[model samples]
Target: MAISSLQEHPGSEVTVWMADGIYPISEPLVFGPRELGEEGTLVFKAQQDAQPVISGGVEISGWIKNSEGLWEAALPKELDETSGFRELFISGKRAARARFPNEGYLRVKQAGVDRRTNFYFQKGDFPIPVNLEGVELVFLHDWSISRIGIQEIDTAADQLIAVDSIGARIPAFFTIDNWEPHPRYFLENAPEFLDADYEWIFLKSQNKVLLKLPQNVNPTNSKVSIPFSQGLIVVEGEENYPVKNIHFEGITFQYSKWEIPEKGYSGIQACHFDPRPSNEGWAVVPAAIISIWSENITFTDCNFRNLGGSGIWFGPGSKNCKIIDSSLKDIAGNGIMIGEGQDRIVNGQPWWKSAPEQVASGNVVENSTISQVGSQFYGAVGIWCGLTAQTAIKNNVLFDLPYTGISVGWMWSPEATPARENIISGNHIHEIMNILSDGGGIYLLGLQPESKVLDNRIHGVKVNAGRAESNGMFLDEGITGVLVEGNLVYDIAKSPLRFHRATTNLVRGNFFFSDDSNPPIRYNTTDEEAIEKVDNLFFSEGEPSYQKELSHAISRWEKKQRKKRKR
Candidate 1:
């Protein structure tokens, strides 16, 4: 019979026969790539009763071939258990060798199994060469099948397989090679491959990234040199790269402590360079341990602890900044300092032979806790705002501070060209002890125009006799348009509130109480009569002498008001 083109229907087997005993089984045979596709079985069967002596009980087994011309034998009913296994075989000329490529491995339960079988053909060893580039090989055993190996042929093909296996886009930059161990090990050990020249290099480890400084590359212009403009550039575990206009959330900076000149070495020093006053050059003198000099920046929900100097410091040029919902503790200097720049003038002569530059402006620090700062000999304020305009310190809770809770001062430039508009409000300050320092809950000094100190609660402020001048709130010298109102001051050692050389200030609606050995409030060289003492609840109700003095002051105020009406 002559062979013709045949087509098979669904669920039915088709057979084809050629003349001269050369038979081709077209049914149950799929010719194409061997991939996971539609679920159907391909079975090939030899024609029964074709010859006189039928090979009965001696069945001839066959296998399937893939696009790479590799033959994989089909498993019997008991051996075909897993759905992932596929088989292929190859045919070569002269010497037929069925070679399993690297991609052909099956994981099986019973370890030792014969993978090669010897079959004698009439044509004296017909050679079959197996091509394995894109072939799938499967092995089957009784009731169990295993995948022993998987061959990744090419890089692009392997990447495609990986993406398809994971059902997602493979991360472009990741430690895929080190999938067994931690990924950081690969990132840290391997050098980054970049096309362009980058000065800074960061090696990320498990906990931190170590930034290697270029060898012997001293920056002539600045002390601390940051080579990168953006992203994380880890510098000795301190990431100090300049990130422009990007919000970096939930990053912790661990700085090594350096000792002060007086103290022994081994603490983190707060060293940041300030470009202002131009002539001061780089203020390499350590200011705060972790000084942030970025403009329009905010640090929220952060922790800055165990530092040698201030916890966080902001330079003068830093504006519209916020440090909120953070805790700063156990520092040698102030906890959080805003605008504490160096004095432009060194001595009688300006450092640049002129007045110091104008200070920074518009800093806000709110909803923070500062505690356990400054050792016995040294003193530190909780929140210190210096030489900055429109700076606000509000809703903070400060305790165990050696000097003051909140201090606003013009200590750097006495000229006050920049007009510090400081506001300290709604803060709970207590337990500040300092000797030979103006210890207070809130201290304002030297020409803060338009400053408001309101709604603060202060208690347990102690000043040792002949040690320091203590007050709940102290305003000193050349402060104008100041309002100290609605504060509860109690248990103060010296005075609840004191003013020295302060002018045009409104002191009203404050509750001042001092129990034994401390004055309720005092004023020195200030226009005490002009201070509005309205609605001030003083705790002198039981003491008749104190009450008489309070009455006399009220009468004196009334008499002065009548005289003003007459005038």
Candidate 2:
């Protein structure tokens, strides 16, 4: 149904209530400014106590076991392979694509011999059988990941060659940083690599899918789905006329997928998912929900899982949006974001300084749970805001990711902008930067005046031996006038708080503890003219407060087991 089809009655309202079932949409459901009713509000909500699912996938049924003992299902021949399907879900759970060694990754012997497109394996790393034709190598370095397709495998030399497009784009992957002989990559999505029961693979040319069923499990007992849509909903309003007063409640969105570029893959900031060999500059990947040039939107009591890119993106010019009491799990990128547009830096000046950046402001993400994000791209965060102002991220739970939990600001310099006057408080964050390093539970960048980090609980940041250490809160490059107060951070690898070139900030009433003998804070600069610390802060005294620290600083996983035993 088109938004123009909505009847407009003067001084009246409109509500489109959905029922409890799955509504799979192949194309993006776009809402423009005309969607506004006569009373200027539109509510696309689920019926009370009903769970409506708006999915971006199709159900695949009629499964039978092949002669080779793998579950085989016929796929639709009409399904487009140009933008291939990359994710699979069975019985409401995500299943991993076929991979080898089952548990850990294989070490690399060499990045390549003066080449940017090949990786040589260690002596026992690339066995003859597992190094096959269609296998992909998923590389994990400091704060970035890339999934590159294998073009050729030389069993004689234990080397795998990639397509012409592997590392040509990102400077980190091809041109600059090197990851020679690191145990940071794993091979995925190959038949030879499918040793586990929960693993699956798809062959588009054959119009078939293959899976190894777990013991006592069969395809008949599962509801398998393959993602085919990149975006489920898009709200794009015109420049001056904005879509306003829209709300979504009690809806579940699942199974959106990302396809690798034909020229292979590279890494960019926020782990850009666009395939780029032919295309030069950065392009924004689609999300499950995107709002651009809109206002006064709310998404409450919703569930988002098995996603490809970001769960929700409030693009530039979008403001006054709320996402509350929601859950985002197993996502490929950020859980929620605002003000993600193009950024260009040249000759020590940003493009926004000259072009007058469009900032999304007054967004709130509160009382929500965001976990297992940055699944495909480990460089993103749970809640990310760039050039956004007056955003409040409070009372939330963020965990089980590779990178930072909440990231604010885009610029790295001290130039003032609207990305300030934000508040981050009353949140519980743990188990962060599990794969990627050089991040923290909460990370702030650039200049954000009147921004405050208050009353949050953070812990469980371990060191990734080869990468830069992790922290609880990081004020990086040109942070000024931000207030840090009443935060409890403990059990981390390094200092709980670190500031780089930070100046004139109020840091007080924050509790800090670490398992090792390092200080609770690391001030990277001697520019005392810029920062204020050592005031009203409590470190682990190893005596009176140590017992209190045990319960507060205890890991959440251990805490859960203790509660279970008590019951």
Candidate 3:
């Protein structure tokens, strides 16, 4: 209301000053076209020397020691029996959901006949909690993770049936394959599994939260926060009316949560999911702070942490937006998402190109630190840019991720689209590809002419639990006219550079080092003429000739495989 009234004076900027301390809101603070006038700017600025937090969490208190030496807390009066949360934070650290086999995963003995609703567990592998209510089965795919509720477990048959279908569309991705004869799985959210320290289970029927904490720590002194809302801010605008010129600074956005749908969270890749049938548009998990159809928006010196979903998103039609000097940590999904997912239909056909006015372009994320992401969803990336042009991702430090560090381009084929001239440069990316396979430190897909991947330091990409190999820079499928130069890629388990189904990519002046059986450069379904590699040094221990390097790569691979077989 104050912002609207302040807009009465045209051409004058409207400023909302937030003071230090936490400002909890029941719902997301929305800013739409109506909140922004045509000419002036709207600024949500923290006071000088102050850092304000916009939180969507409710603190739970009134703790008491239970008979089993666990701590229990009654729900607040404002909460009811339906208030079920999937995440809980104790003393600023995320507490594990009550899960069986607390340390690692249990392997499936055999995939079910349908392969979408049931699987056969090994003998004595079933968790068999006291009750199946509120229990979920988490299935780990090659590059994604699926969560579904348990409907029945026939111990006599060693089969477990899910309440809904698993969250994968393709059979090869979800079913048992030669690479993984038995998929990994775990069970969560049952009282019987709450035996480990910092594991918790909430009983909505009892209106209480049961927590297993350290014996020395008192529950009354610990700060327990449960997120009640999905998002903290939403900046949305229509096609014809776009919100513009808004800025947020010196703010910390935290404690947002996202619930799994009843059907399940079937992860596809990079946090995109197949919520419905195929050929329809897929869904990307929403973020804690989102902007859609907006322009000239900025978030400077902001912090996003302890979230149940992605940190920030610049959705469709967002232009000239920037997230500068920010830090994103402990995120459950992708750290930041830019642009829209592929397969959005328009006019009764699959939408392959963005409307000129609806493309998310000219956005930038610089000088940021993103770590400990993909905490809940293993397929999430640090930064995902899809079908956007002229987006600059620079000077960011990204590590401790489960999937790719940065992914640009969404189109899987060499088709014309509104994605070109994107830049990924000067980022320090390491310790990525730690969980999933078929991803790289920097992954480029589709046909992005004139795009550049330069000066990024990428390393520590080891082999993970997946069928396909990982790389330092994976130019996958239809990549063309991109210049890869001056990047230092090393310490990779597979290859430093890989090209699959790509053409005409210029690779020059890059230092690629590998200490394994894989070559520094690898090509699949691609011809030698397709990639122009000039002055690129390929080193295992020292720089070797390209021809000699190929033979050494084979010998090294054989040695590694022999070692693995003996193990």
List, in order, the clash count of every candidate structure: 29, 3, 1
Residue 153 in candidate 3, Cα distance off native in Å: 1.4
Residue pairs in clash, model 3: 167-266
Which is the better candidate, 1 or 2, if ranked by lDDT?
2
What is the TM-score of candidate 1? 0.47
Tens-place lDDT digits, model 3, residues 244-283: 8889999999899898777678888889886654435578
Q: Sorted on lDDT, highest at the top, how do the candidates line up?
A: 3, 2, 1
Per-residue alpha-carbon lDDT of model 2 for 1-567, expressed as tens digits?
424445445334457899999998877888887665423566788998889999888878878887888898877554645455777888778788887667776766766765566767766664444434456777766666667787787877878777654444545444313543453677777777777887998776666789898768988787888887778888888657877777888889887867766665566556554446445456544578999888888899989998887889988778799999999998877888877533545345553564344568888998899999887777778988878888899889998988889988877788876677999987889999787777799998888899999878888888553446689998888898899987888778788988887778988877777554677777887375456665544566465777566566445434643563476
Q: Where does candidate 3 stray beyond 4 Å?
A: 81-83, 170-173, 176-179, 276-279, 346-356, 542-567
- Winner by TM-score: 3
CA RMSD, predictions in order: 34.0, 4.4, 6.8
TM-score against truth, every candidate? 0.47, 0.90, 0.92
Model 1 per-residue lDDT tens digits across residues 460-539: 77654232367888887776678888787766887888878776778888777765665677777878776666778787
After superposing candidate 2, which stretches have Cα over 4 Å from the reference? Answer: 1-7, 35-39, 77-82, 129-133, 164-183, 273-275, 278-280, 341-351, 354-357, 463-465, 525-529, 540-545, 550-567
lDDT of 2: 0.76
Off by over 4 Å in 1: 1-248, 251-255, 262-293, 345-358, 411-415, 434-436, 541-567
